[model samples]
Target: MAVTLTDVAARAGVSPATVSRVLNGNYPVADATRRRVEKAVRDLDYVVNAHARALLHATSGLVGVILNDIADPFFGAIARGIQATAAEMRRLVVLCSSSADSSSEFAYIEVLRRQRAEVVILVGAAPEDAAYRREMAGHVRGLRAQGARLVLCGRPAPNPHTAAASVSFDDLGGARALASHVVSLGHSAVAYVAGPEGRTTGTQRRLVFAKALSECGVSLDPALVVAGDFSRQSGVDAVRRLLASGASFTAVCCANDLMALGAMAALREAGLRVPEDVSVTGVDDVPSAQDVTPGLTTVRLPLEEAGRRSLALAFSGHDFGSPVVLPTELVVRSSVVAPSAASARRKLA
Candidate 1:
C-alpha cells in the first residue's frame, strides 16, 4: 500500500495540516515541527514521485520558465541553475521567451497554464508596460484561484495581493559602485554605453551611474552618453557615435558584458588599444569576460543564487512583491588604465 498523509501525520504525532506545511516548505511551520515531519516521512519510506502522483492528480510535474533574453550569458547561467534544481527534484522545465513583448508574454502564460505547469518562473527585468503588469497579475491571481504558483526572477512589479514571489539582484548599488570606482581612478571625462533607455534595469543603472558621477563632482556631458538595446551591434554603434562626436573621454563603462566586448572591438577598429588609448569596463562577469583580449574588467552578479532563491520562493508560496537583493562586486582586469596623453591629443587634433 502507498504511504498517505495520514500515515505520516500519525507517525509524527502531528496533524495532517502540519505535515502538509512541512512538505510544502511553508515558512510558518516551526523548524522542530519540520524536522519531526521529515523524520516521520523517512520512517514511512515516503517518496514524492510527483510524476506518478501528478498523473493521477491531474498536475503536471513541470515548471515553466520565461526569460526576456536567453541569448545573454547572464540569463543562460540563471536558466542552468533553474534546470539543475528542477532536475534534482525530479521535475521538468519548459523554457520560453517573452521577447520583451507584453502581448506575447500573456500568450505564453496562457499556454503554460494550459500545459498544467505547477509553477512558473519569470526571468530578467519585468516589462515596463502597465498592461503587462495588469495582465500578468491577473493571470497569477487566476492561477491561484485554480491553485498554482508563480515566481518572478529579477525585477518584478509591485503587487501585494498576488500569488507570486520574486528574486533579484542589486542593480543600483552595483552601478553605483562601478561608477564610483571609475571616478576614483581620476577619470573625469568618462563615457557611458547604456542599455535600452526604456527598460527598468537600463534606466536604473544609468540613473545610479549619473548620481555617482555627480557625487564625485564629475559633470555628465550629454554628448558622452550613448543608449542602445543590450546587443553587440548596439555597443558598436554607441562607441562609434561617441568617437564621431570627438569627445575627450578617458574611460568607457558599458551596461553589460556583450556591449563591453563590442566596445573593445570598436576601439581597436579606431586604432585604439584597450586601457592604452581608452579604458573600458562592463557589467556581469560573463565567461567571455575572462577569455576576451585584455580580459574585460566587469561586475559579477550572483546568477545561480538568484535562480535558487526564485525557485525556493515559488515552491514555498511566498509573496512575490518582496524583492531579494543579491551582492555584486567589481573585478579588476587588464582592460582599464589611466588616461593616455595620446588619447587626449586625438580628441584635440
Candidate 2:
C-alpha cells in the first residue's frame, strides 16, 4: 500500500491536520514539531497527493504553452525561455503542439483550461480570419474567467475586450526592413516567398515587403510572387515552380530562415549562385540562418526574450489589451549583394 499523510501522522504521533500544515507550510508549526513531521514523512516514505493539494488550492501548478510546432526551431527557442522562467517559478511547464491547425489549437487550450493550468500562453502568429478571432476570443475570455493567465505572443490583438496579455515582435517593421535591404542592393526584379495567405505572418509580411518595395520605387513582380508554407520543403517547391514557370527575377526574399535555406538549395541545384547569380534574404535570423552556406542576411527577432516577457505579463496582475511590441534588428550576412548584370540576362532554359 502507498504511504499516506495519515501514516506519517500516525508515526509522528501528531494529528493529520498538523501534518498537512507542516507539509504545505501554510500554517506555522513549532520548529521541533516541523522537524518531527519531516522525519516521520521520510521514515514512512509518505507522498503528498498533488490532486488533493490542487483541490485545496484550486490550481495545479501548471503553466501551459501552446505552439505551432515543437520540431520547428523557431518555437524551440521560445520554449527554452519559457522553460527557464517556469523552473525559476517552480511551475511545471507543458508544451502542447497545435501543428498550426485551428481545431488542434482550440482543443489544446480547452484541455489546458480543464487541467486548471495557472497560465496558458499561445505563441506565434494568429490567423486573420474573423471567425477564428471571434471563437478564440470566447476561449480566451473563458480561460480568464477561470483565473487562468492568458498570453498571446507573436500575434495581433484578437479582441480588445478579452482579458489577455499580448507580446509580439514587429512583423511589419522586420519584413519592411528586410525588403528595403534587398531592394537597396539594386535587385529590382524580386521574388517573394511567403507563408500562407490567411495567416497574419504570411499575409502581413508579404504586404509590407511589397509596400516597402514600392516605397523604394521598385515593384515586386506578380509572376514571381510564390506562396510557401514557411517550411524548408515549401521553399524548395516554391522555387522549383518559379524556375519551371520561366520567371525573371534577380532576388528572392523569404518569410523565414528555413524557407530561405530551402530556396538556396533549389537555386544551387539550378546552377544559380547566391548573391553572385541571385541575391536572397529571409526574416527571423534563427541559428541555422548563420550556419548555412553563404549565411542568411535577415531580420533578427527577439524570440527568447518574448517568451520570458509573456510569463512576466502573466504574473503582473494586469491585463494588456494592446500588444507589448518587441524590437527587431537587421543582421547583414554573406547571402545578399548587389544583383549581378549576368543574373538578369540568364535564362532558365
Instruction: Identify the leading candidate in terms of lDDT.
Output: 2
Instruction: Give the winner by TM-score.
Output: 2
Give Cα-based local distance difference scores for all models: 0.78, 0.83
Off by over 4 Å in 1: 1-58, 158-162, 347-349
1-349 in candidate 1: lDDT tens per residue?
Answer: 9898889999998999888776655448765676567657645756456753453235486798988887888888899888878887888889887787766776677667656688888887665667667766767654554346777777655366666776777777777777778788768888999988667778777887788778778977878999977788888899999998777788899989989999998999998899888999998888999998899888898888788777766776455455677888888889987667886676557
Steric clash count of candidate 1 = 2
Give each prediction's root-mean-square deviation over alpha carbons.
Answer: 12.7, 11.9
Return the TM-score for candidate 2, rounded to 2 decimals: 0.81
lDDT of 2 by residue, 144-245 (tens): 555688888887768667778888887767767777788777778889898888898788788888888888788888889999988999999999999999
